[model samples]
Target: MNDQRPIVIIVFVFIISAVLLTKLFMIQVLDDSFLKRAERNAIQRVVDHPYRGLVYDRNGKLLVYNNPIFDLMIVPKEFQVKDTTRFLEIFGITKEHLIETYQAARKYSYVKPSTFIKQISTNEFARIQDFLIDYPGLFIMTRSVRSYPEPVAAHALGYIGEISGRQLERDSSGYYVQGDYVGLSGMERYYEDQMRGKKGVKYKMVNVRGVDKGPFKDGEYDTASVAGKNINSSIDMELQKYGEMLMKGKTGSVVAIEPKTGEILSMISAPFYDPNSLTGSDFGKSYTALNRLETKPLFNRPIMATYPPGSIFKIVQSLIGLQEGVLTPETTFACNRSLVACHNHPSPVNLFGAIRNSCNPYYHQAFRQIINQEVSSNTYKDTEIGLDIWREHVMKFGLGGTLGIDMPNEKGGDVPSSKYYDRFYGNGRWKYSTIYSLSIGQGELLVTPVQMANLAAIFANKGYYYTPHLIRAIDGDQSKIPQEYLTKHDVGVDAHHFDMVQDAMVQALFGTAQRALMKDIQIAGKTGTAQNPHGEDHSVFIAFAPKDNPKIAIAVYVENAGWGGRAAASMASLMIEKYLKDSVSRSDLEKYVIEGKFMN
Candidate 1:
């Protein structure tokens, strides 16, 4: 304003020229910056790994995605980290760590590049990367490591790591080279081929000092990398997060499925870890720590554990009896505790009442009728025939076998066969009474929690079920999933029979599992206090909400809990309420399940 423009311009130019001249002296006299560009160097072909696909929950919440990382790769012969003090200080590592890493890397290869220090976070590398040019033999390579914000689903969304020797040899696609990363489990492992896009190679001309000059052959010899296809999963991240929280301080699993589409809403295995912890340089340390855990956090109990299904199996028994025509709605059995012990409920209950009360003695008599309904010459022969038929019908509900969920090493679960009985009790020696305990869902029958969730799906769908699955679609298209997952699997039982069972399951919430019944949402559920011979009984419960046009079907198992109503059903009720309403109305119950210690 006071005619100072000429003075300001003169001073600005003087200061800029002085700074520029100083910088030119540093680059020209001290070290070469553009000098490497002036001397054309040899082209180094670097393999560029495509960014792994991003994973998002059903509502577009990001579950897993790529984060930029720098791996310090070394060509042992070409790399030299002189000045131990400077090297250690620059990298923020100890002398022993540098030596051990170098030796281990050399064992891999002396000439070829191998990762010396893997998975350095972007922020950490930013601090030292400017000084990396002073070092030789070591070069920074760009990579993407997995990052999880919530750390909710470690088992459901498995992590990625370097391809092992066995994996490399088995790769028939010829896509993997050394130092490639691959999906190891869950949705990652299932859709590996699609999730990991094709790799590209770039040839960059560099000087003898390992400095990049420019693209080799004017970029003619380089192939561009294509990022992986994004996957849209059916998991409700909020529900998954809530389920995981409810299962804290306990040992068990909670799996919820969409009754119509079989899209898994949530699959929670307790003692879970944050997926973020396994991503950085501490991956090996985290793996070893998790491996040593006595709780066996790595063990996926939902799809892997086998336990007697307890009173929940009564639903299967009730259906099998109806299909066999040996038991009817009008059928009554006395709960006199004559054959098995009971906790003093009313006697001579009908089928509906039997299911409502989960009367063990009533199921015992009902199972006996089905097993000994003389279609054959003798009762023994008839019992074997009926038992075989029952098992076949039961298998239709995806029991005693894998539900074919998109997970690796999933257990098919065990359902005792005649051969099983023959080996254990001798073929002809066993009959209905000898194996009467199975009538109450005990003795030799084992089922996975996934299978149990599928059973709830079957009941909700009324005699038919789509396979319970984790994937909804790939790349936002629902058709990308396998055809079998969409196909309806029907149990041989009549659809009308499920109505009675549904009513009974609903009545159970008002009776045995009243704690599980939420206001305004009619939840149909069954309680299972399973016998654990070595210790206390395990708590188990299965339920579906809004009985008509169901949205969520859930199954919960709490090890060493006293009863299903206490832990399993209570937690399940909270989950159902949360999913349907988007917030809980039962804060008191939520606090109990979240804070209470159910097991010793």
Candidate 2:
């Protein structure tokens, strides 16, 4: 019985030892995945943002660059604010700021690091570094902020700001987080991807003190950030600066373009605010001040503000008249001061003479003839082909639609069609006589400063123009304007018709804008004093010079500047001479435009 009892005890002890070993093996091997995940929770991954791209003018002048900025970051779980008062005094912040920052960090997650203070300048960074040792959980990180060197072109270059919540949900590659910056307007918004570089990640092993000890697993997962692509703008810095100077204290816009390439040399929208004002810490206050100003400095008048083309549009009417074969160069029409008289003189004026005199009656007659011919034509009797033809010709010139420029927020000026007329005056009731105002570029015919400038470009090129653009290239690649834009568009008129029209424009310079003419240069231009609904006439001028081999084409509009030849014409001529001849011919004219004050 004693031998049997010893054998039973041995067997029970062996079984108990075997069960303990099996359990130990399961914990070490089978549960390894769970333990590994727990370790990863303690180690956090952080993204490092790369520097934004630089912007340069056509002549290689730096428009925008980056400046180093310091940001104070906090890891809420590790933060121990010892002596809160002293910490506040050192950082030059209130206790509320610290509490708010801590709360934000906690909301993001106690394990994640968050920004507490951002955009500390170099001087502020120097002062903070001296006392950084006192703060354990807080650390300084280096980042880059945009810096405008020229301080002009604010609207064109645009501004960058923090991304909104809506942007994050839509683009969830983690491309943007809570505080990521994005372009808000102009070329910046149009080319965000090229300007914002890719973000890089580093898995860091941080200690309980929030100190980055080293990379987790020796940085096998770290990615290097790519720098953003640089942009080369088509804007000529000198010309842009000069144009802005000319537009000082005025509410207007001036757009200058190279006829052949369609590169915008200068685009000035008056009442402009300094771009540097919207950058850095004072942005909120500065933005409020600008918004409250009576003059809306933020408005981009070149592409956004639509106005009547005025007498400059008479050129289009004349071309259309000649193209439709309703009027010949020798066709004569008389003009008197009477509003009701169609022809008041026995002496007949040719096309060149009529344009030189700006005879409204001649265009009225020609437009009526065109309408009657189209409505009575054999192809489609009663089909209003003349109005359709006119609409087609205008649309071919890039009117009535967006110009597809690189800038954001361009408004397409309205160009009414035959259908629009039909809507206004029931079918077949409204004739060319009912809408005679169209002959003078009034009524519903609206165009922008950019469009007018492009009109001048088309005439200068003898019938075609490239798409006007501000940025010339991205990283040295030329623009992608279509070949059709470079090719001439026949306005259904003979080349000889252009010669007559060109002669008339030249005569206009000799007649009304004679005071603006230079001694050595020949400038072909047209002056327009468009009647305004709000107040006095709006002075406008469109010109291209040397006349023979046109170089710079420009359009200028001055609100309430009175006579087109006096204010807008003088300014346009001065700019043209300054660009082509590199100097002004009339010192009195220059002083008048520079000092002329108009009541807005």
Clashes of each: 2, 0
Query: Which residue window of length 10 is worst by lDDT in model 1?
Result: 36-45
User: TM-score for every candidate vs. truth?
Assistant: 0.90, 0.89
lDDT of 1 by residue, 463-570 (tens): 988887777778888888889888888888899999999999999887788778776889999999999888889999999988988999999998888688889999
> What C-alpha lDDT do the candidate models reach, one value each?
0.85, 0.79
| TM-score between candidate 1 and the true structure | 0.90
CA-only RMSD, every prediction = 12.9, 3.8
lDDT of 2 by residue, 336-374 (tens): 435323323333567777777666777766666766674
Q: Which stretches of candidate 2 lie over 4 Å from their true place?
A: 1-44, 130-133, 172-174, 340-348, 377-385, 479-496, 583-585, 598-600
Task: Tell how far residue 332 is off in model 1, in angstroms.
Answer: 1.0
Worst 10 residues of 2 by lDDT: 339-348
Number of the predicted model whose TM-score against the real structure is largest: 1
Q: What alpha-carbon RMSD in Å does predicted model 1 have with respect to the real structure? A: 12.9
Best by lDDT: 1
